[model samples]
Each structure stands twice: as C-alpha cells, then as structure tokens.
Target: MNPAAPVHAIVLAGGRATRMGGVDKPAVVVGGRRMLDTALDAVNDCARIVVVGPRRSDLDSTVLQTQETPPGAGPVAGVAAGLAVLDAEPGDRVILLASDLPFAEPTMVEALAAAVQDADTVFAVDESGRLQFLLSAWRIGALTDRVRSLGSTVNQPMKALVPETFDTVLFRGVTDCDTPEDVERARGRAAASPVSIAEARRAILEVVPPLPPRSATLGTSLGATLAERLLAAEALPRIAVSAMDGYAVAGNGPWVLRDDIRYAGSSDELELADGEAARIATGAHLPSGATAVVRDEFAVVTNTSDGPQLSRSQDAPVRDDARRRGEDWHEGYRLAVEGTAVTPALVSAAASAEVTTAGVRGPVRAHVAVTGDEIRREGPLRRGQTRDALGPVLPQFLSWCGVRTVADTHLRDTSDSFDELFREVRQPDLIVIVGATGGGAADQLRAALDRAKARIVVGRVQCRPGGSQVTALLPDGRVVLGLPGNPYAAVATLLITVPSIVAALTGRTPAPRQLARIANASEVSGDATRILPAVPQPDGTWRVDPGIRTAHLAGIIDREALALVPAGAADGDLAELVPLPR
Candidate 1:
C-alpha cells in the first residue's frame, strides 16, 4: 500500500476441483470473461504476475507460470512456488488470489493492501463473516517466513499459513466459484442484469458467431454477405467496339467511305485502309485499323469522284466515341471486398464482370410469430380482442434490417403454444416472437426458452418501453428475438436491435450510427434512454415527438426517423437516428 513500494500478484489456479467435476475451474467463463482473466485483471497494475498452475496455452506469454511442489499440493505449496520466482523485496506487497473469484476487482485488492497498517497481513471477509484466506495481501517478509517455518509445503492447509490476529476488510463482490451451482448462479446473475444499448449489442456480437459460408450463384445470393472479395473475371469491354452509330474511320478526316456496314454482334473482321471509313453501329467491334468513331451527327458526307467522303463538321466537338476494351474493370481487379452486402447493384456488377458464383453467408431468414389470445388478425373483433397491427408489417420492418421473414402466424396464449411452435419449425435462422417477454400470466416464452435450453444473451435492456426485450441463442444456432406486444415498442426495438442480430448471423459489418442534433431532447429525455418518433425541421436539427402512444404505430405516420435520446440529455443534444423505412 506504500506509495513508493512495488506490488506483485500470486494467483493460485492449480486445483483438483472435485466439486466442479475435475474440470479446469480457472478457465471456466463467467459473465463472458474467464475467471482466471478476472484475477489477472485485478492485479494488472502490479510489478509482476505469477500464476501457480499447469501451463495453459491461452495465457499471455508475459505471465510467469509455475507448478506447486510435487504438483497436486495445496494452496500453501502454491504460494511457496510463486514466491520462489518473484524478485520482490521484503517490504513489497504481494496480492494472493484464487482464480475462482469472478467479481474480485483491483479496488478490493487495494483496500486490503491499504488496511495492512498495524498487521503483518490483511484479508477479506465475505458477507457471512467467513475469512477469504486466499484473497489477501501480505508483506513478502511475513509470507516468506511463514512458508519457511512450515518447512514441507506439500499437502498443507490454508489455516497453517494464516497469521493470528490479521487485519480484515469486508467485501461484497468477492464471491468464489466452488461448485457447478455456484457457477450457474453467477452466470444467471450476470444475464439478469440490465445492460445499456451499446453493451447489449457488444454482448450479442461476442456470443453469436456468423453462419458458415457457402458458395451460391449470384442470382440466389441476393441479401447475402460476401465471404470473400469479389474480383473481375474478365474485362468490361472484351474488345474495342463502337460507342455510337458512327463511322469507324482509319485516320483523320476527309476519308473515303467503305461499302460494308458494321452491325452489332457481327464477328466479321475487316481491316480498314488509311483513308477508308466504314459505317459502324453501337456496340459493334471496331475494325483492326480504325483509330476512332465519328457519330453521324458529327460527320459531313459528300460525294467524291470515286466514292462518298466523310468529314467532321466544323461546329462539332473533336472526340472519339469508341468504347475501349477494359474500360470499366480489368481481370483480377477487386470489385467488392469481404463483408459487403449482396444488393441488386452488386449482383448486376458481378454479372457484368462474368462472375457466376460467390461464397456468402446469409440474408438471415426469419420466422415471425405474434402471441396473445386477445389479439385477432382478421374478422370481427370481440370486446377484449385487439387487432394484430404488428403481425402484418413485421416483415417490412425486418426487411429494412436486412432480414427476410419466411413465415408469419398467430400463436394462442396456451402454455404449450410456444413449445409447440419452436418444435415444429427448424429451417429459419431466426425466430421473432412478439409479446410474452414479460412475467405476465400469458407470457410463457421465457419458460419455453428454459425448456429449449437456450442461452440468454440479453435478458433485458436499460431503455424505456423497449427495456423488456430479450435476445437469446438456441442450441441449434438459431436466434430468438422477443419483442414487447405494444406495436410502437416492437417497431422501435426492432429498428435498434435486429441490425446487430443480422450482423451476428451473417458476418455483415455494422453500419455506423446516424447522429443528429435534437432541438428538444431535454423535453423527451427520461431516466432511461427514450426512443421516440421525430421529424426533421427546415434546419439541420430534428424535432422530437415526445408524447406518442406505444399501443400503435399511428404516431409515426409523419415521422422521418426514431430518435434515440440519451438519459439526462439536455436541449440541442446529439441523438442517434434510426430512419423509418419508406
């Protein structure tokens, strides 16, 4: 804790882990990061980091690794092995850690190190007042003396090294993983926490991998992402040809016209003399000796003693109208790079370049389902029935996000309805379920996901109206996007979320966010990020529509985009814009 003294870390990562079924406990991932990495991160500012464990190839090469004496020996022996490799002084502080604590942070270590004022060592006490002997800070002299006194460090218990009357600092987040249930509890707690929009997107990207690439013809590859760079197979203009219906003259001006007429798609090759001119049509290949093509409007024809002579008009611009070979692109030239979308323009360009097939990921096919017994899609509505406004238009919204909806249907609010729907469908890459994201009586999607053994990536978000959204990945590699039953909230969440899902599934590069200054952001900003419709004013700034209803999309009829106003934003603040599909 001294300002001038150095601090080193000794992490005990070698363990039998009988309670964890002999698995590598330090390598176990919690909260998207490895537990061993958490311990190393807590001591990242230390002078040296020594990990006492079996050598792991995934560890950084700079980190020092050593095995305890006689290998399977206990924590005391691990401490001795770590101290042997450190070149620390007697007064230097040593942070002792067990690599199973996922929530142990550097602040906790600093507090423990600072609390060692009147004692030889300082350790943490958990919420239950149980001392965490391994999560401690010790003076190198004291630790060395204790290890030397113990003599044989093999199979020693932690109690043998614990100094009597050591100082203790209470910590709340130093929970350690000792069993499978503890690991699961940590994972559940991490998943249940609400994340910001950026955090949610980052988490989705970290967990979801792109689908495997496959070769598909350009005709069938529309909406797919290019897996490799698209190169020109051949030149745009295979050979020199006429750009207009003009004369293919052999040399400059006042030339005698030839008798033969050159038409398009004709392969007849004829050489032109120095003073000869031939009538050439558009797209027709030029003769071997032709230098340029003069359009009919730009040429003057006159009868000569032998034949008709062609001359350039004095008022016409002096220009060559012949299309040159390799004008657009030559062979081996890169047309599109990897991760580019296969839009109509790209397809046409590839076709023009004579590229027939390409390696690509998906266009992300999705299956849409609108859940709720009270929602009716057609026919006369009963007293409690509400019309399904989102079911019909969900595909259009998804299309704007680059997802093609394969099928859409209505699901009743029965307990087994979601389970049956998931079991029946298997082709689509995504399943979009509207409603049933909350904990209401009719909301059975979460329970069905549990039965399906899906991995929940984003349980909830820290946003208004759309905070109840959920994104999960099934074991079969399909994604499930759960939206609120409210139509406006569904559209708002879809606009902001589906793009990330598409990128995750198809390996498409995420587009940069569109930012615009909102003139009245303070009026619409709330404790959580507020997503609302907005209209563009005559000026460059946007005007927010703060008081729109979420039950339907009527409020967005005249809106240009949805403004993502940040929490606690002031007037004239910049907000991200999600443009509505026209």
Candidate 2:
C-alpha cells in the first residue's frame, strides 16, 4: 500500500470492560496516557480517522468521535460505524484498530498499510500467531464487499467476515491488553456501568403506565384488554336450544314427525303434541311443548296412517341434545376476566352474552417519526442515503401491542427538526422517535428532550442492537421512546419495550414470555440478556438465528419469536421467547 494512497483509520473505542470490572478501557491511564491515545498514535498519518464511542475530550480536536448505532455494540459494529463516518471509497485504504491495545506502535500500522499493497486485507498476527482481526488494514471496497457477503452476521466476530477464497497477508507483533496480570495493574475505578436490558425496561415502565379505562364499542374492541370483567346480561341459551341438527320430541320413544321446521332465532315456537316430533336445526330454539331433542341420525322414520312418525334407532340411544339454560353462562356470570385480551373468540362470546359495549383499557395514541437526514423516503437511495424501514412497520406493530397510531411522519436530521416534532406533539400519549439518540453530531433528539426539560425514564440498555434506546417522560403527560435509526435495533427495542408500556398504562400485566427449549448454542455477548431472532420448531424448541445483525433484516422477516437468551445460558436451556410483530 502506497503512503500516497488515501487511508482512513477506524479506532474502535467502545469496550464495556466487564473483565476490568466495568471501567472505560479506552480512557484507562496506562504509562501516564490513555490507552485510546496510544492506539490513535499508531494511525496519526492516516488521511482521516474516526473513533467510535461517546464523545471524549481526550481525543485530538481533529479526530472524529462518532458512536455506533447503538453504543457499546462490540468491535465489528464500531468498525462499521467508523467506516460510515470516513466517507471513503472502495479503493481507499483503512486501518482497523481497537482502543485497548496500550502498547500499539506506529511502525506496526506502517507495516500493515505497506503489506496490504499485495493483498486486499492484512491482519496482524499476535506473538503467539493468533490472528488479531481488530489490528488490521484493508482496502475499503474489499472490506465493505466482504461485510455485505457476510449478511446479517456482519456484527459477529471478525472471523465471520472472512472471504471463503481471497488474497490476504499476515503481520505479527500486535499485542492486546487482555491478560489478567496486565488487567490487574491497569484497571481504573470508573463506575460507568452499562444499564442492563431488564433495568432499562423496569425503569421505563416505572414511569409509564396505561391510560384510564374508556368505553369501546363491541365492533371496535379488537386488540384491547378488558378493564372490567365481562358479565353476562342475559343467560346463555335464554331458550332451550338444539345442540345438534335433530328432531324435538314431545314424548318418550316413538313420536309423530311433522314437516314444520324450526331454524335458529325463529320468530315463533311450535307446539309438539304428545307422541309428536318437530324438526329443528342446531342452535334453534326448541318449541314450547318439546321434551328432548333426538338427533336426526338417532331417529328412525316410519310411514304411518297419521303422518310420518319416528322412533329411536335400535342401535342409537334416545338422548337429548339440548343445551340447558345457563349451561355456558348464567345471568350476571363473569364471561371474561378483567385483563382478558379481546380476541375474536372473546368478542363473539360477548355478543352471545348480549354485550353491546365493553370497558377496555384504551390504547395510547402515538405519533411516529423516522428521523434521518440521509434517509430517503422514496426512490432509489444515492450515495449515503438509505430507505426508511421503521416507519412503515411501526403502525401495524403498535396496533398489535394495542397502541393506536394517530400520525406518521419523516424528519430530517436538523437542530430544529426534533424541536419541531416536539412542538407539534399533541393528542398522542407517546411520540415515537427513530434515530438521533446517540453521539452523532446530527443526533438532536437528546438535546431537544433536554430543552423541553423531559425526564429521562430510561437510558442506554446493555443489550446489543437495542442499547441506544432512550425513554423519556414529558411534562405534558406524554412519553416518547427514542430508538436507533437502524431497522433491526429499532425493531428489537420496539418489541421489548412497547408491550410493557401498554401493560402499565392499561392496568394489566403483560403476558408472560413463553419458555421454549433452545435448539442451539449462542455465544453470549455481554452481561446483558440477548434477544435473538428465533423460529419455534414443531417440537416446542426454539431455533435461534444467531446470524442476525443490528443493520440487516434478511432472515428475520420470517422470524416469529425472539429468544431472550440469558448472558451465560447454555444449549437446551428453556429461554423466554417474546413474540415478534406478525
């Protein structure tokens, strides 16, 4: 690689530092200097450089500090985020270095960029010959192409992006600060704890709950939870009803069969004289003088001088097929629980119980905005622009979670764009914001919330693809959840948080997560619980899709459940599964 060839360096600085007891590894002082500064010195000659993490004053004013879509999303994610900030073309040279290498030297990077002249990528091997993927140099085009080929697994280990057949080179002597002995001496006392996924959810729900109960028309009660018990106004089977297509007999055994037929909900009831039978349909009200209903299959008809007569078949017993009054529900009997979901079957039950209206926990009216300046609402994207994926899917998703979406809009990345949305936020109990929650210079949602004096109910969670979500409660009795711009992250956070919010507002508890046996093992990322896309197998086990990434949605379109695998869960563990939007 020629020194004259444009080069960009990406310094991944977002380690959660769990091994070091939750310190900021990049900011840790080693040899009287921050480890990140040591790493940055190695690539000082690069045409441009980007550091992926929170804004740090220790960085050179010229160095770019941007955050991964959801901060603390691991090295691969930081690499991608750093790449996005570079604005480099395919043929440009890039050096990927981690911030934890306290002793990294500039000569190592010079050797890497020089070695990459013969290969598309050159990874530095450690003294022990172990590949240090984070300490590498690559042609920007080649690296991105390989990343695209890796599909949604791009966020996985760097090994995942290896081209099956390609040219590569190896340089040696790049050491990382991972030894327990080295960690013991250099660990700092920073208490920058990453919020756990559970903690974030609990905090957000603690501040947000369901709105008051409201009357809903029976026809429009779908998807709402009942705020009050559905009691029966009239006894089920108000009249003796036929349970099957049969004849209503007036006496025991042999009877006269008449042609007069009685169908369900008929205006009048006919009298069945002694030894006579009346034809009746299933669910039909029995005639006033009828005794028991003998099914059509159980009756044996015979021609007689009086009329067509019937008797119980010798093979079939003479039993009544009648539904007795109040067998299903008596007058004033509880038809449904207070928190019962108003499914189609339940609504039908309400209709049968003569319920014309219901007391239901009303949905929180929501306004959705998918924000980004580089986001193109329509037409093919050009250069850095991307298609908006979160807006179209959210309306349907919120409906499933019992939220009524009142409006939808797209916002550009601007200082006042967030302020405008907040100013117009009315009627809705929630204003859902996508993007603009992280450390990007263009991220204005956070500043806007601060300007409005909104109380942040939840901050960054420790979960991958969803850590950047922020929930805030406004003074105007409304709340909003700021989600990551990436479609996968937005979706992951949406599924986990929305249900809990709905349950809180409606005075009902969310349905417990379904526990399914995990069919495969997944590498635990961090201390937080991970939500992986999964398909529930016919055998009641969940097939986890570990291949999903924060930016891609390829295999996830067909996924039904997201397995909430615990931090140290093993294969065959019964993991809790949350439902995805259908």
- Best candidate according to TM-score: 1
Predicted candidate 2 versus true structure: per-residue lDDT over 1-582, tens digit per residue: 455678789998885677777677777654334678778888999889999888887667889889876766666777777878898988889999988876688888888888787778888776576777888889898888876675553347778766654343454534566554564333221102245665555555555656778899866867677899999899988878999998998978688888999999898748888888888999998898888999988888999898798899999975789998888889899988887777788889888999978888765678999888787778998999887766887888788777889899998877898777878777887888989888889888878987987766665777777777888777786888888888888878888888777776666666876788887745543466787898877887778876677775665789888877877777778777878876
lDDT of candidate model 1 versus the reference: 0.89
lDDT by residue (118-234, candidate 1, tens digit) is 567988999899999889989899999999998899999988998776888999866889999898788667678787887788767767779899999978877789999999999
State in Å the error of residue 232, model 1: 2.8
Q: Give the TM-score of candidate 2.
A: 0.64
Return the TM-score for each candidate structure.
0.79, 0.64
Candidate 1, residue 397: lDDT: 96
Q: How badly does each model clash, as a count of residue pairs?
A: 0, 7
